[model samples]
Target: MARWKAYFSFKLWLYSFRLKKFLGYWLAVFSVIWTFTEFSGYFFTAVDGSPWKPNVWGVIGLGIVAAIWMSRPLLRRTVLLPDQEVMLEIDINDMYARQDGAWIIPCNRCFLHSHIDEQAIVVQFRNRFFPSPADFDQVLAQVLQNVPYELDTVRGTQVKKYPIGTVVPVQLHGTRQTAYLLATSELTSQGKGDPNLNHLEDSLKSLWSYIAENGNTEPIIIPILGSGRHRLVVSRYVIIGMIVKSFLAGLAQRKFTKRLTIVMQPKAFIHNQYNLDEIESYFSCAGKFEFDSKGL
Candidate 1:
């Protein structure tokens, strides 16, 4: 019964209104080509008194249309802002893949939450970039060595509390890409990840500032903030909206990276059932806001 429900859900998305909008684009293009051939006889011509046979061409056109429609789910949506200098891409892929741009790793204020499970993106990123835990820690220590921290806001077992929205950049040992660690949560004295929506917003703003000053105009890649273990009692869609809004708002203050890619894991993408078309529309609407490209 569960399997049947899942199957039906998949079918529903296959014919969803959002998918129709995408398919409409390709279908219109096909129509134009088909009409052009009818008038110009570009590919098909009448032979001996028999009219040009469109059967073969029609089959080929339908096949091409089907291929285009089926490929939609496999592709992500990308949008360029008004200035056209920056771009935003949304994709369902592995963030740990050795991409060219820098990535944002959400970390606790302490920056040393060693409880293992508490670190989701952090752990995955470390395993991919560093040889072992010790190696990653060595690099982290060096990066945070002189960084200032706050004495208050200590909760439960956490002692030294770094203020939220702290951004620290760590260059992966072997790769040209850098990992910008943003403090979005505080480690509970028990050493669990504790985060709120406010913190996430602040962290995103700080992230843009750091990127503008130090990101060197490289593309910035990030995962959906407030997801996984951080516990923001909101849907992934809302979290995505918040991230977009904050990033755009930051852009208003000053231009940051040339591109920002939001990478969502395949599991999260399917389980959450994100409608890319709707998200794309939201991005377009968000871009309409008046923004100052110059630094404030």
Candidate 2:
């Protein structure tokens, strides 16, 4: 009887286990879906009863939106869904220019790398922190009240200052927006950006968890992770896809209230590395946004 009870208990536990992960994924899925709906939300009238024509104004509006996005250092069009949206813009002109929203910057397991030598967050240090470069660890320790703690699951499994997949929140100099010091990769001896997708996924999972619990509905800005100095060996083609898949799979299952944007550099987009047209098509695909009609 005890054995049977234990087995039953384990099964029951699985139902609610990692509910947060479930939420994140579904919400992300919904974001894509919602954006597609918005893009296709157009209908034209035919008083003569000949045929229902596509709305020219609507098409023009979408074109204008597309033009604005293209003009900016953007790869993907801004996707607004249900109660949230996702954008792909450039941070080249100004990395920390946004007045609001939490800025997420990737760091190593130790969170002790130099911005000059390590470009993962060079933009933040140079433009955001300004004046003198920031001592990130010290900033985390003193300002955010975070201490380096050991977290397993990455390649460089060492006693480190910060936990893997967790963020150390800090405030930028000129702005009141909080800077979420998100650790996306481990300091691989092979170099930076080599942290396996599993680790990156976990870090992203941690990101959603933080937003759900401690974050408001403010906009959040993150870059195309692992595309910088760390240089993860994975093809650039899959980087955005991986991020989208992981993020949508990790958004809160119901009532995801935050706006998320992925910033891409203009040079990268212009170089034809990522097919912007394809990305635009992907967002507008009706099939990709299918979900239950429970009204999230």
Candidate 3:
């Protein structure tokens, strides 16, 4: 029964939408199912008995769509965390302060920046290390002087070999959560590639590899990494869906936990079609499994 129900929704999505889009199609879908139900009723009437006698499939089809809509409140309002069975929750909330979970923050190969980014997660994290009223570069120098490493500060940030598709875990002091400096791009050049899907997918794969090897066994909390400072070209919905896919794929390697939590920056638009509500709707139900991408 579930398989057939999924098939109906999948076919509706497969028709015209590529990936990361299903909401608008969903409206049209209700009509399509209505028409299917009517046709089924007519066909059954001719073949067996009165059309009104039983239209079980039609009722089921409409019921499924209604159920999806009704479930939205639970999907959006609840804080669904990743656990042993692989469930994901989407929230346009803070990523830094999540409970004992590790955070996966993206960075350039050189994890340094001139000024704090107003929209990126790094800004929220800056105070944790340098505090306020402190010069970012100078504070970095003073902080780095005590550490035993052969790195230098440049471009408003410290440099490293964290090229695209690499992740460096920066363990925090007096905290259970470690900060993963997920390297998503070489150095975020102006005219060059920012976040092509190939790089993003590979980075996700690398991130999972690190998790698998380290065996940290902590619930993971990650922001939508590329959308803000990284200037990733993908739409929010598309990227979020991509993220769920990669994360789920990673879990298959080893069930990191039962739930995966993603913290989205408060958003109004992502390629104009996606939003946190849709993200909640998609992942909490059939959309996550049905979604796929040609670019990635």
Candidate 4:
């Protein structure tokens, strides 16, 4: 009897949590109500009374309640996904060492950092910690010597005077390699973007294109673009959503496999910004991905 009770309790728990089972119960209840309404309508018509009116109202009310309940689960699922699968810690002093097919390099002059992948590197510059152009150039030269491709030309620094939320993809050391620099004006002026969705879209689109072109065969390393001291006020959810949307859009256009590695500096900040639910939601929406923590 105890075993039977335990089994029944498990079944009840499953019924309550499983979406299919919950919907099934609602559907069955509605079906029975429909049948009763049909029979009562016929009987009431014969007796000169209306029984179908209450049945119709009940169905509408039940549907509204069911819809509200169903939405709760869907919303939770959407918000709980993980945006970036792999997360690594990077330090300024040990930036040259290779880990998992990539290197995390810290800039000498500014808070700006670079994640060097097999084919390319993503350099994130926070306006709050602006590095001199010469300092940036020197670091780039040093980093290029260790990379696989030859440095030809550096492109896309023309719009440096623009506001926060500007993303410029430049040709670094020629056309063989590229470095995408995401600059947010908020970090420079007040620290944060204008919460403009279009700005986020533009930034993601540029990053996505770069990833789609270069990251098909090699792993791409990225940083938490705007979550630093520059834009310290931004919500993790919004940032996560923007990253996920951009990656998905970019991935959809690609015909090959890609591995993206996102590196976070000051790891404690990222941990505080996002929780397990956001990470889970990002993965669920992203399809196939993995998560790991790397200490630099």
Estimate, for each residue in 49-135, the C-alpha lDDT of model 3 and write its tens digit.
Answer: 568343556655765566455433221233343343555676445666466577887756545554445555665565655445255
Per-residue alpha-carbon lDDT of candidate 2 for residues 2-32, written as tens digits (9 for 90 to 100): 2233223433234323445545544555455
- lDDT score for residue 231 of model 4: 38
Segments of candidate 1 deviating more than 4 angstroms: 1-12, 15-71, 150-159, 291-296
TM-score for all models, in order of appearance? 0.77, 0.59, 0.58, 0.39
Candidate 4: where are CA atoms >4 Å away?
Answer: 1-135, 138-179, 184-197, 214-216, 266-273, 288-296
Which of 3 and 4 is ahead in TM-score?
3
Listing every candidate in turn, what is its Cα RMSD in Å to the true structure after a full C-alpha superposition? 5.2, 17.6, 12.3, 17.9
Highest lDDT scorer: 1
Residue range with the least summed lDDT across 10 consecutive positions in model 4: 89-98
What lDDT tens digits, residue by residue, belong to model 1 across residues 1-296?
A: 33233333573356343555556765676676667657666555677755465675775677567646654443367888866467888776677763868888888887763566634888887776778789887887777778776664444443456678888888865668788988998666666777678788778777887787777777888998879878889887888877777777677667767778888776666576667767777777767776442321
* Candidate 3 wrong stretches, greater than 4 Å: 1-84, 115-118, 130-160, 188-193, 267-277, 285-296
User: Distance (Å) between predicted and true CA of 118, model 1?
Assistant: 9.0
Model 3 deviation from native, Cα RMSD in Å: 12.3
lDDT of 4 by residue, 20-40 (tens): 655676676677777777777
Q: Give the Cα lDDT of each candidate.
A: 0.71, 0.55, 0.57, 0.40
